[model samples]
Target: MKLSISRYNPELDSRPYMQDYEIALVPGDHMLLDVMLRLKQQDSTLSFRKSCREGVCGSDAMSINGRNGLACITPVRTLHGTVVLRPLPSFPIIRDLVVDMTNFFQQYHSIKPWLENPEPPPEKERLQSPAERERLNGAYECILCGCCSSQCPSYWWNPDKFVGPAGLLQAYRFIVDSRDKATDERLENLRGPYRLFRCRTIMNCAEVCPKGLEPSHAIEKTRMRMLHVEASGELDTHTPPAGRPSITN
Candidate 1:
C-alpha cells in the first residue's frame, strides 16, 4: 500500500510537504491507525496524534483521501488506492499530522460546558427525561474531533473570534439541556458579532463530522432564537462585542 503523508518542520521548512511510504497489507490487518502505528514503529520520528485506538479519544482525527474521519475507525481497504493522509485542512500545524487544538479548546470554553446552577442538585444522580436529553441530538452527538471546525471557513479566516462548529454545538448542547438554567445568559453571550451571526449555514461542519453531528442545524436554530429574542424587544442592555465580524448570506 502507498500512503501519502503531510510533513512539516518549523526548524527547517517554512511550509509543509507530502512524503510517501509503502507497506504490505493483509486482509483485516490494516486499519488506517494501524498503518500509521506501523510507520511510527519503523520510523519513530514520524509524527501523528492518537489515543484510545478503539475510537473514543478523538485524538487520531485527520483527513484521509480528502475526507475527515477518526483514523482508528477508518480501514485501509476502504481507500481505492494511494491513500492520502493529511493533517486537517485548517488549524496551525504543530508538526506532521498534529494540529494545535488550543484554539478549539478556547472556543469550547466560550460556551462553558460545565453545568452551573443557582441551586445545588439533590444528593442523588440527577435524572433527565429521555425525551429532554435527546432534544438536541445534533449537539449531544459532537465528539470534539475538530473536523467540523477545521473544515469551517469561518474558523479558517478568523481563528480568534469565530466559535466554530464544535463550540457552537456545545453551546447549543447546554442551551437546550433540561437541567441547565442559563439559556438566556448563553443567548446573551451569543448576541455579539462573533456569536451566532458569524455562522453562514455553510454545512461544512456537518459534512465532515465523523459522528454525523449536524452543527449547522444547531447554529441555525440558535440564530433564529437570537433573532426572535431581539425582535421581542426583550434583549438585554449591553454593548456589542468589539472586533466581532458580521455574518452575511
Candidate 2:
C-alpha cells in the first residue's frame, strides 16, 4: 500500500509536510486504521488518535483522499492509488493527523447538550409517548467526530461565531425532547444571526458524517420551530405507555 500522510512537529519544523511510505498489506489488514498501526511500527514519530477500533469512538477521523471519514471504518480495499491522509480541514494542527478540537468543543458546550426541564418531576418519572420518543432518532446519533463541521464552508469562515453543524444537531436533540421545558430558551440562544443562520445548507455535514446523521435537516427543523412554523412544546399528544423509568429523570 502507498500512503502519503501529513507530518508536523512544532518544535522541530516550522511547517507541515507530506511524508510518503510504502508497506505491504497483510491478509488481516481490513481498515485504514490497520494500515496506520502497521506504519506506526516502522516510524515511532507518527501521531494520530484511535480508540475502540469500531466506528463509535469518532477519535480516528481524518481527511482520506480529500474526503473526511473515520479511519476505523474506512475499508482499505476501497482506496485507490496513493492514499492521502491529512488532519481535519481548517482546524489547527496539533501534530501529524491530530488537530486541536478546543474551539470545536467550546462551540458544542455552548449549545448545552443535556436536557433542561424546569417543571416539577412526576412522583415516579417523566414519561414520553412512543411517538414523542421517535423525534430523537436522527438527531441523537451524532458522534462528535468533527468531520461534518470541518467540511463545512460556513464553519470554516465563522468558526468562532457560528455554532457548527455538530453543535446545532445536538441543540436540536434537546429542543425536540418532550420532557424538556427549556425549548424557548434554547431557541432564543440560537436566534443570533451567526450562531444558527450562518449555515448555507451546503449539505457537506450530511455528506461527511460517518453515522449517516443529517445535521442540515436538524438545523432546518430548528429554524422552522423558531419561525413558529412548527410547534416547539412538550408534544404530549398520546398517552404514555408502561415503560421503565428514565435514568435521566
- Candidate achieving the largest lDDT: 2
Q: State in Å the error of residue 13, model 1.
A: 3.0
How far off is model 2, as Cα RMSD?
8.8
For model 1, what is the error of residue 218's alpha carbon versus the real structure, in angstroms, after optimal superposition? Answer: 0.6
Candidate 1, superposed: residue stretches over 4 Å from native? 28-30, 237-249
lDDT of 2 by residue, 57-150 (tens): 8999999999999999999989999999999999999999999999999999999989897778889988999999999999888889999999
Expressed as tens digits, the lDDT of each residue in 47-92 for candidate 1 is 8998888767789899899878898988777877888889988778
Candidate 2 clashing pairs? none
TM-score of each: 0.90, 0.90
Best by TM-score: 2
- What's the residue-level lDDT of 102 in candidate 2? 95
User: Poorest 10 consecutive residues of model 1 by lDDT?
Assistant: 240-249
**How much lDDT does candidate 2 score?**
0.89
Model 2 bad stretches (over 4 Å): 229-249
